[model samples]
Target: MSVLPLIFTSGWASGINAYAVVLLFGVFGATGLTDEVPEALQRPDVLIAAGVLFLCEAVADKIPYVDSLWDSVHTVIRPVAGAVVGALLAGQSGSVPELAAGAVGGSTALVSHLVKAGTRMAINTSPEPFSNVIMSTTEDLGVAGIITFAIFHPVGAAVVAGTLLVLGTVTALFLVSRIRAFLRRRAQRRAERRAGQAVGPPV
Candidate 1:
């Protein structure tokens, strides 16, 4: 089977939660749940590192500005992870197939990562904190679902991932104006508060 399916699926998952994808692959490979898992991923050090990072992400992703910062930091990490996963799935090194797989994975991951990061930035403009938690949780669940399914049915998972990528990108971009409005409102509120404080209490 061509590695394209896994490449796309991993790419999408990496955009949402690269550490979780890595941890899943490491755990699956370590436990012998699947043969397609990579040997390096099965290493204890890799598993530990991915696990720790995943934990940090799980917490940071639920905070507003913190989540944006986290996404910015991972802009590179996620795409790199996608490429690595693709190369492993290709089952070769330095060959044309592996290189192509890496390119596909990296490109796909970049698109989804941009969508995820942009959406999160937009969401952060709101004053409510719960939305961040809700969205982050949903994304984490989505990544888990897709990666788990990809292990057995890569083609189906790829289709789902592709659909999601397109829809999410469109939706986030559509909300840009609204996010800007929210930011304006929040800024106005802050300015009003500052002005009130500056004037001192009326006698």
Candidate 2:
């Protein structure tokens, strides 16, 4: 019954979509739906801002290259958000140091962010945009499900989320070579197209 599970799960979720994580905690905390959230996040302004940002991210995360761009921009933001959320969660119990929670959250977020960014880099190489859309939707839903579960069944949620995070990072690392090969192939194709254009018609 330690709150570590909820904190860890939230930190992991924040890495994927910090705004959604913030919005979830804020709304749920404000509504008294769950006692696990911190009062600091229950403020009206925090909830509104998080909700707006979540909307913005929802749109940006569906595009092809745009999603990658968004991820790059959030390289710092997401991890920081994760740390902040973790610190807040820890403050509720008074048994843990907020700094310690922040460190855990930040580190977990960084790992998850790398996996997400690397996967998006690979996915961007695809010609069709459908895969990007599907992946984005899947991530959003995954975050949502994890947060909701953490509310009522924190330990179970933490286990499941941690498993996925580890799996994703490992898979992304394994696919690095494949991703590099894909980029090389794409560059070659582009070069061939340019060469063809330079040579002009056979005449």
Which model scores highest in lDDT?
2
Highest-TM-score candidate: 2
Give one digit per residue, the lDDT tens place, for model 1 in 1-203.
Answer: 76688788998898889899989988877887888777888889999999999999999999999999999998999999898888887763333388788888888888999999999988887889999999999998999989989989989999999999999989888788688787799999999999999999999
Q: Which stretches of candidate 2 lie over 4 Å from their true place?
A: 185-203
Clashing pairs in 1: none
Which digits, one per residue and each the tens of the lDDT, describe model 2 over residues 83-172?
999998888876668999898888788888888999988888789999999999999999999999999998999999899998998888
Candidate 1 structure lDDT:
0.88
Query: How far does residue 198 in candidate 2 sit from its true spot (Å)?
Result: 13
Cα RMSD to native, each candidate? 3.9, 2.9
After superposition, candidate 1 runs with Cα above 4 Å error: 92-96, 181-203
